[model samples]
Every structure is written in structure tokens, then in C-alpha cells.
Target: MALAPRHLISLSDLDDGVLDEVLELSARLKRRTGRGELAGKTIGMLFFRGSLRTRASLETAVLQLGGSVVNLTAMSDFWELEEREGSVMDGRAPEHIKDAAAVLSRYVHALAIRPAPLGNSWDVDRRDERIRAWAKYATVPVMNMESSLWHPLQALADVLTLKERLGDPRGKELAITWVHSPTPASPSAVHSLLHAALRFGMRVRLAHPAGFELDGGVLSEAEDLARASGGTLRRELSLEEAVRGARVVYARSWQSLETYGNPTLTASQRSRHIGWRIDEKLLASGQDAYLMHAMPVRRNVEVTDEVLDGPRSLLYEQAANRLPTQMALLVNLLR
Candidate 1:
């Protein structure tokens, strides 16, 4: 009998051994060693929202590895999908997700979906219903580009970038500090990075102002993983305290969980934290830390222009690594 196809919905789906293999393969592929591993494969990428880095990187990775791609944008290239179970089809959505997933499976060797949050409450979004439903119905391997709860592909590229810079990441200090943004952002990137960093035995510090805490369930699981790997996890309200003595200072903005799904409330709370921006002086407090951010960052808001363009900034490298790491993942899943 044939085995079931593998799906990468979250970092937790990969244990230590498989995770390490993926990272190692990513490094090898980065050195131009592995090529054409995805020949004769076709990948279908479905995007429910806009993207720059994620779309470009994945398409480049597939083409470079000798594979073809079919890209579709929801509500533009396809119909509005209904995910609710046992619902009447009298609403705006004309088709259900079950039909979509099943049809896509037959057309492609692997299926990848990127579903943004639907302005819903934390309790509803945290279930990650869209991607989970795809995985359940698709016969081919399913990959998560980014969802309401996790960005496993981004986490993979992050770990690969860290491995390339800092040989062995074990016991190294990594500070994931929250910065200010004019608009509310998703916490999926932060949550995935926390999981990946802790799994590699890196001591992580999460710093954010009051009322801007991350999801409690993600924190608890990350803490447990940290403990098992001899890594430590701590929370700091002050940015200075979190960045101090850290090897890597990663800055990003995320919405407050307390006011999530309420735009007006979330905006009012976020406005008060504008003073939390990262600058050179703040970054200097760390122990020669390298700066990192998943980009499309607002200059002078989230971080200063000097800091983002400085020699110590690894933002570009992080973006560049997305290609090779995704190439590695596609090869692993399809072959």
C-alpha cells in the first residue's frame, strides 16, 4: 500500500530529526549542490491575500528546481470559498472549500495555501480552519504558505538563516521584540519564529508593552519546548531589557490579543506604543546583536533607516534564504 502524503501545517508537525534534515538540505541547496530535484512536478499555489516575498520566492524556487507552477488568487482568479460545515449556499460564497481542495489535488502534485485572518475573534481564527480543511480533503501533500495561526515556511527559512550565520544556534540569545506600527499586524510570524527558535535550543525573550501580549496557548507550548531542549523563555515589558545581551534582535509589530478583531480598540491601544520603535542606540544595548525583520517594514516607524541598511542587518539575507529553504521543502514533500 502507498503511504499517506506529508503536510506541513505547523513547525510542530516536524520532529527534531526531520526538521534538522530540512535545514541541512536547505544549506546544501544554498551552496548550489542540489538541483532539478522537483523535475516533472507541478505545484498549485492559492493565495487568499496579497504577497510579495512569499509569492516570488516560492515561484522562483519551483522554477529553479525544474518544476511548473499554477498560481491562483482568491476572489479574483477563483470563487469565494465557504468553509462552514453543513451550511446553506445562499450567501456570497458560491462554492465550498471541500470541492476546491479535492479538485486542486487532481491538478497538482502538491497544494499550497495562504489564508489570511478573516477579521474574526482569536478563538475562531486560532483554530486555523481554512488550511486544516485543505489538509483534510486534499489527497496530495499540502503546504501552508501562511495562515491565521502559523507560517511554517517562514520559520524554516528563519532557522536556515540563523544556522548559516551562527554555526550552532544552541544556547544563543534571541530577542523577539515588538516594535510600533501604524496598522495592526498578524502574530503568525512571531508565533512561528518562537516555536522554531526554541526548538533549536535558543534562549528567547518576548518583549511587548502591556495589553499587547501574544496568544497564551502558543506561549505555553513554546515554553514547554524550550524546557525540553535546555532553552529558556522569558517575557519582558521593556524593550531595552529584552535586547540587552542578546545575540540576535528581531523586531516586528503584531496586534494586541486583548483587542483582536476589534479594529477601533486595537488601533487605540497600538497608538500608545509608538514610542517602542527600534533605533541604533536601542540596538547597541545588545551584545553585538544582528538585526532581523521579516520585511515590508515601515522606515522611521518600526525601525530607523540607518539600522535597516546597516552592515549588521540580516533582513535581506532572511528574505533571500526563503528561496533555497522552500526549494528544500518542496523537494522533500514531492519526491
Candidate 2:
């Protein structure tokens, strides 16, 4: 009998050995050593939100691997999706995710979805109901393009970037610091990056304002993974203190979890940390640390131009690695 299809819902779904294999394969593919691994396969992507890197990279990766892609943007290509398990069909969203996932599974070898938080409470959004619903109903392999709680693909590219730059990341210190942003941002990248760094045995320092704490469950799980992988995890209220002597400094912004569901309250809390923006002086605090950020960053808000354009910045390389890492992931999932 054939085995059930594998899914890439979160970094935690991949064990150390499989994670290592994907990264190694990513490097090999980047070196022009692999092609056509995804030949004759089709991937169906449904987006509930907009994307630049995720959309471009995945589409390019599939085409480069000799596979075809079918893209669908919610509310444009189709009706708004109802994510709740059993809701009256009397609302704005016409179709249910169960029906959508099942229908797409018949047309593609794998299904991928990008669903952002619905501006609801963290308690509600953290469950990642939309993607979970799709995964539950889709017979084909499911991939998380991004979700409320995690961006596993971004985490994979980040780890691959670290491996390429640092050789072995086992003992290095990585600081994931929260920078200021006027608008609220999801904590998915932060959560996944923390998980990836910890899994690779890197000492991870998470720095953010008091109200900006990441999900407690994610933190607890990361701590456990760190202990198992010979890594150490710590939290800091001061960005400078967190980046001090670190080998890498990753700057990004996240919504105030304390004010999670309220945009006004979240904005008010974020305003208090405007000084948290990353600059050259802050970057100097690290051990000549390479700067990194998942893109679409607000210039002079989250980070200064000097640091982003600096020679030590790994931002572009991190973004570029997305293609090969995702290609490797698709190959592993489909072929």
C-alpha cells in the first residue's frame, strides 16, 4: 500500500535528520546540481493574503524544477473562504475551506495555502484554523505558505542562509530582536526563526518590549527543542543587550501580543518602542554579526538603510535561498 502524503505545516513537523537533508539538498540545488525533481507534478496555491517573495519564489522554484503551478487569490479568483468548522452559509464568505481543499486536491499533486490572521484575538488566530481546515480535508500533501503562527518555509531559507554563511551554526549566538513598526505585524516569522535556530543548536536570544512577547506555547516548545539540540535560549528586554556578542542580528517587528486583537491598542503600544529601530551602532554591538530581515521592511522604521545595505547584510541571500529551499521541500514532499 502507498503511504499517506506528507505535509509541511510547521518546522516542528520536520525532525533533525529530515531538516538536515532538506538544507543539504537546497545547497546542492543552488549550485545547479539538481533539476526536474518535480517534473510532471502540479502544485495548487491559494492565497488569502498578498505576497511578493513567497509567491515569486515558489512559482519560480516549481517552474525551474519542471513542474507547473496554479495560483488562486481568495475573493478575486474565488469566493472568500469560510474557515470555521460549521458555520451558517449566510455570511460574506460563500465557500468553505473543506470543499475548496478537497476540490483542489483532485487537480494538483500538492496544495499550498497562505492565510493570515483575521484580526481576531491571538487565542482565536493562534489555532491557525484556515490552514488546519485545508490540511484536514486535502488528500494531497499540504504546504504552509505562511500562517498566523508560523512561516516554516521562511525558517528553512533562514537556516540554509546561516549554514552557507557560518558553516556550522551549532555554537553561534543568534539574536532575534523586535524593531519598531507603526503598523501591526504577525509573529509568524519570529516564531519559526526561533524554532529553526534552536533546532540547529544555536544559542537564541529573543529581544522585545514587555508587551511584545511571543506566543508562550511556542517559546516553551522552542526551549525544549533547544535543550534537546544542545542549544540555549534566553529572553531580553533590551535589544542592545540581546545582540551583544551575537554572531547574527535579525531585526523584525511583531504586533503587541498584550493588545493582540485591537489594532488601536497594538499601535499605541508599538509607538512606545520607536527607539528600538536597528541602526549601524546597534549592529556594531554584535560580533560583526550579519544582519537579516524577512523583506517588505519599513525603511527607517524597523531598520536603517545603512545596515540593510551594508556588506555584512544577509537579507538578499536569505531571500534568494527561499527558491532552492522551497524547491528542495517540494521535491521531498512530492517526489
Candidate 3:
């Protein structure tokens, strides 16, 4: 009998105490570097899509903690994987997810996966079938760099950034607004933040267009947490309403689940809200509002260069926090 290995698949996966511990450790690691706790460890990173921050940050984090990494692009480095339960192997993809995951687990101390959400099945993709398939078969702990539905590592960094800037995240007016993007983005980041904010008892104001709302299940859970934590998680259709007097204005844009898998429709839906882009006017709502984006932004579209380079923006710090934050996560999981 052995203790089950820990996996961070979602922010919701971390309880309040564990989240607090991770944030505190992240702060410490940022102030004073880690002790190379994973001197002999190896991390196998598989990306189903392209990434700059997630991969580089994790690679750096592993090395800083004295661990090595094996980077693999699923679509290029190896055979394409089939995630279905029982599928005939006659197509281009040769390897099944089960075999790929189980074998990878044997070769590395831990497995981290970032999968794309491009598929016709909202039901399957929304539930993150590929990541789940890997987790089901892998022998070692599985961490999510980013999945179809969530990005816990990014969310964790965001919380660290907020705590560092605000000192105390509780009882603060936090605005989570939606901006425009060329393509529909994943709602997981905003969802993850809402979960963290509510758990910290912050006043969370989610502002998005009519069809750009977040997942109902995530919202429901956050609402419950808010009630219990003495915080509020309410939706606001107007950005002004959401950011007014807020301490932090997190500008984000997510795909319209209503038109998921339909690019034309989703694009059309997103186009109507181009004015939703965050500019200086929006920042005026909270002069000291710490502008935050998840990165890989569509500058001048989702956010203006003015706001991004302004004194209040935490973009660079937010990005830098990813390294130490992930170092904390790896040390906690792999140490």
C-alpha cells in the first residue's frame, strides 16, 4: 500500500490550505531561490500545442530545482494519439493515449501535459478527455501545464502576483473582465482565478458580453464558495461596472462556448465586442488597477500597448512569477 501521488489538474483540485501553502512557498522561492530539491529528477513535458511561456518556465523551473526535462511535441516528436476509449487503429495516429501515458510515466519522475482543445466534441473536450486519459493510465503523478479546460499553473502564478502586489488578496475589489481575441480563448484561466479569489474571500466581479459568460458549473461552485467565505462572485455585463474602484483589473478573453467548434460563428460573436478591448479609459476606473493578462496577448486587440506598458500593468512580473511559482509546484510535488 502506498500514498497516492499528487496531481494538479485544476485550481479546484487544490484546497484552500494547499493553495495558500503553494502561494506562500512561491513567494519565498521568488524572494530566495529553491534548494535544488529535485537534483536527480526528470520531468517529461508533452505539449499537444505550441507554447512559449509554459514550456520555457517549466524547463527553467526544473533546472533551477536541479532536475532535467524531456520536451516532446505530441504532433511532431511522436505518433499522434487517439483518445477514444475503443478506437480502431487504421488512421494516421498510431499510438493510443493509454500506452503513450503509461510508457511516459515509466521514463520520467513526473508527467506534465498541455493539450489543445480543438475538437468537435464539446462534451469530451470540455471534460478534458486527453488529459484524463493520460492521468488514468500513467503510473506517476500528472501535472497540467494547460489542458482543454484549465491552466492551474498560470492561475497559481496569477495568485502569487496578486498577493505580491496587494499583500492581502482578501476583501479586495477584483475585476475579471473579458477582452476581444482573434480566436476564442479557453475560459479556464478566468474560472481558475474566480475560484482562487472567492476562496480568498475577495469581491470578484466577472465582466463579459452576453454570450461570453464562463462555465455554469464553475460559476456555481464559486458562488457557493463565496457565500461561505463572505465574498461575492457576481457577473457584470459592463466592463465599467466590473472595474469601478477595483484594486485589480484582469483583462481576459475566452471563446464563446455557445458557438464552440464553429469558428465562423465564434469569430462573428467575438467581433461584435471588439470595443471590449482594454484601453486607458478602462484603467482609469482604477488608477492603481494592476492590469493582468494570461500572456500571448493579441496586443492592440485584446489590450492596448499603452495599458500594457503603463505603470499599473503587472504583465512582466506576472510572466516572471511563472518560473518561481512553477518551481514551488514542482518542489511540492516532486521533492
Q: Which one is best on TM-score?
A: 1
Instruction: List clash counts for every candidate, in order.
Output: 0, 0, 0
Q: Rank the candidates by TM-score, best first.
A: 1, 2, 3
Q: What does candidate 3's lDDT look like per residue over 110-194, in tens digits?
A: 9999988756756668898778878888888899988767889989989888888888888998999998888656887887888
Candidate 2, 1-335: lDDT as tens digits: 76777888899888888888899889889989456887888999888899999999999999999999999997789878887777888989878888888888899999989986777788989998888888888999999998999999999999999988888999899999998887656899889999999888999898999888999999999989899989999886489898899989988888877888887877777778789988989889899899999877998888888888889889999999999999999888886
Instruction: Please list the residue runs of candidate 1 whose C-alpha ends up more than 4 Å from where it truly belongs after superposition.
Output: none
TM-score of 3: 0.96
Each candidate's TM vs. the true structure? Answer: 0.98, 0.97, 0.96
For candidate 1, write residues 1-335 as lDDT tens digits: 86788999998888888888888888888889446787888999999998999999999999999999999998789988888889998999988888888898889999989986777699889899989988988899999998877989888888988888888999999999999998656888899999999988999999999998988999999989998999989996489999988889989998888988888888888888899988999899888989998877999999999899898899999999999899988887877
Relative to the true structure, how large is the alpha-carbon lDDT of every model?
0.89, 0.89, 0.85
Worst 10 residues of 2 by lDDT: 31-40
User: Once model 1 is optimally superposed onto the true structure by TM-score, how far is the C-alpha of residue 299 displaced, in angstroms?
Assistant: 0.7
lDDT ranking from best to worst? 1, 2, 3
Query: What lDDT is reached at residue 213 by model 3?
Result: 74
